[model samples]
Target: MQKSVFLGALTVAGLAAGASAAATLDDVKARGTLNCGVTTGLAGFAAPDANGEWEGFDVAVCRAVAAAVLGDPTAVEFVPTTGKTRFTALASGEIDMLARNTTWTFTRDVDLKFEFAGINYYDGQGFIVPRALGVSSAMELDGATVCIQTGTTTELNLADFFRKNNMNYEPVPIETNAEALQQYNAGACDAYTTDASGLAASRATFENPGDHVILPEIISKEPLGPLVRHGDNQWGEIVRWTLNALIAAEEYGVTSANIEELSNGTDSPEINRMLGTEGNLGEMFGLDADWAKRAIMAEGNYGGIFAKNIGENTPIGLARGLNAQWTEGGLLYAPPFR
Candidate 1:
């Protein structure tokens, strides 16, 4: 089943054709829901909880977009997509946006005709093996059977890393993270290769997580973020600035606890503009003034979202590291709201 009458033209024809076609933002509004593409199931990223509600850092992006556009966070339909299917889902209009942990690469950005709004997480490729393998370093896995996910940057990076290291290895290609975990745990592969953050998330779900160790080698950079289709500037801006608002909210000390109070008034001009107290920024985007406020109130801020999902205290146990705010010496800098 495909929802791609207009998007098919958008994909095959040029950007001008897409622009002349039905606007995705308008389509989403008329449909009464935002279709958001997410991973099949990556813990602390995009997964169903016990009650079947999707929740995670990536899921929050979708909810925020829905809240910003539709004025209701729960108005999003979470579409689970694999690495191979995510792009098609976005291009075919099966999904309005993709908030999975996808990397920003040249080919995907250019050749695939997609646009990454901005990087939400900075990551690196890594290897994980059983502790008993005694493989403390990635270089030790010369003859390892690596479980790599197909249709992801990991495949090429794994090959490149092995070729550059002059090491011989066998590939065990899998589809989703769950399949990778199954194969790696079943001894079908000697090690699993993916983003370091993924390794942590996967290991955290194992029955005995302490039995595995992630190698220290970070083979390649993985700047992961939400993406929208190319040529849909309106839809793109909605997702892009919504993300920036969450980041900016954190930097400006705007949390869910005090958003309502701060909405009444604020001393900082930037905060006032960001929270929609004194600007027509949302109107400039053809949305209500409370667009960003709804988005921020839906999820708190970027740091709060991380801490509640995959941060140091969560099962993923990830530190702020490079994902901390720019003021804190990290790369997470949002543009001025004004």
Candidate 2:
């Protein structure tokens, strides 16, 4: 009787969550804008420009989703969230989806009742220190003070990495990347730890970026991506496929430069289906035929977005490494659009 009662309650809870997720789609459509949660400020990932317009790799995902759903990429309100507030904002419906640099963990996915749409960036935790510290590797810093963002997986990873190595250290807790940068620059911490990509992003903003060197040790696997509340399977699918559309676009040679022409007519059946020329896939998500087309046009495909924001040429200077296309020896492989 206890098990049966618990199962019943679980089902009811799931249905309630699903109802909320379903309503989010309608609410966004009715309001004609997407409320997307983003980092307070992490250059090359998500941050405001001099014009006060949000633009970056992560911001592109939010714009693509807005374009896919509303056919207007600009129809979005970017909500700045710190590591501590991001999940709460998403859970409270303050944001329709979260496009922050959040890792997909088991607890956040199941226990926290959230669903990661898909992995956009394959990252790992690393450390950055001033060159003057003479620390060439993470293992060398035994008693160093570390600046870590609170309410993030990095905190636990920081503790675990040190404990496993039998090292002792002092932690300087911070809430945002800006704070970590300020504290680290002010000598409040000996080292700053976060996703390797983030370290690069933060370092790029330094007065003399070459003054700091990121350690060689990659401490944790952080598959970062967008996420939505669980039990909202349909909304989840919309976000998932929208991201997939961008990945598939890159793999199939559908770029922002050629997407419109290809959408009109393409030789590849997969491209045709994805661009909504040969199938009713959009109907599956309650969107129009040109949904994926609009998404790609919003900020180009995944590779394009990456190159424009954090690629080797950019100040953040990230390479395609693991984020490259599956056909090119990376981990990015999108399911067939058909």
Candidate 3:
């Protein structure tokens, strides 16, 4: 009958959907590269150097995942996306995962049909203005023109902050961090508003970084992280635990220099299990025994990546405030690897 045929077709379509959702890992392996979505440019987070080589804290996550899956850190195609384009790119499967400085939010996670793997950076919204503007705080920018990225929580936060303060401002919508910097420097906007960490990153790129000062007001909580499409739990688990491995590595004092020795078997039972000495934890995720080891070895540990890329010694000069390890009085905590 026609009804029976329609039911069978629906069943086949459901199976196909399930199969596509499960195909990300296998596709990356077959293609030999992980397509990682990143910001167009955000210094110390994700950006290209003068030589056009991409390197930053966010880039390290992609490299670590690639190393874990393919045993090659360089096996990645970095897809640069703007605020408006990032979600579309991920939803359409243009990229395997997004490691950009994207905030995790309710609408994005539920309505937008995406899964935020984990928070890699804890941040808050803040304002940055040229010191010449004589604006010491966000409250002073009552009627200022603000350069903010569209398609971001920044826009909503900016609106809320101004309304709460009973102030008003004009929004100069920008699509990328580089554009926001350009517009702010050109005096197109009176202030550049974004996550406080981003304000530091943006200011570091200026010719005279000292000319701009980030206002001290930390307005909104921004827990930025990697995300994947909603329907794929397997893919989500792979990316999520890959990040957790990095964090856990730092917690256990497992550096890249000693990962090989630790893989041989550590005296600590937790380290042994994490390094795949006792169980087929990697195999459970359809990876090799040395997956986490390779990921940690690709970069160092979480702290190592942070220090090398965007620490206070670097041009970005970001201190480990809220981003420090949980034990160090910050919120960066990893769940038990065991």
- lDDT per model vs. reference: 0.92, 0.94, 0.91
Candidate 2 structure quality by residue, lDDT tens digits, 64-103: 9999999999999999999999999999889999999999
> Which residue pairs overlap in candidate 3's backbone?
none
Worst 10 residues of 2 by lDDT: 16-25
How well does each candidate superpose onto the true structure, as a TM-score?
A: 0.95, 0.98, 0.95
Instruction: Write candidate 3's Cα lDDT for 282-308 as tens digits.
Output: 888799878888889988999999999
Model 2: what TM-score?
A: 0.98
RMSD to the native, candidate 3?
2.6
lDDT of 3: 0.91
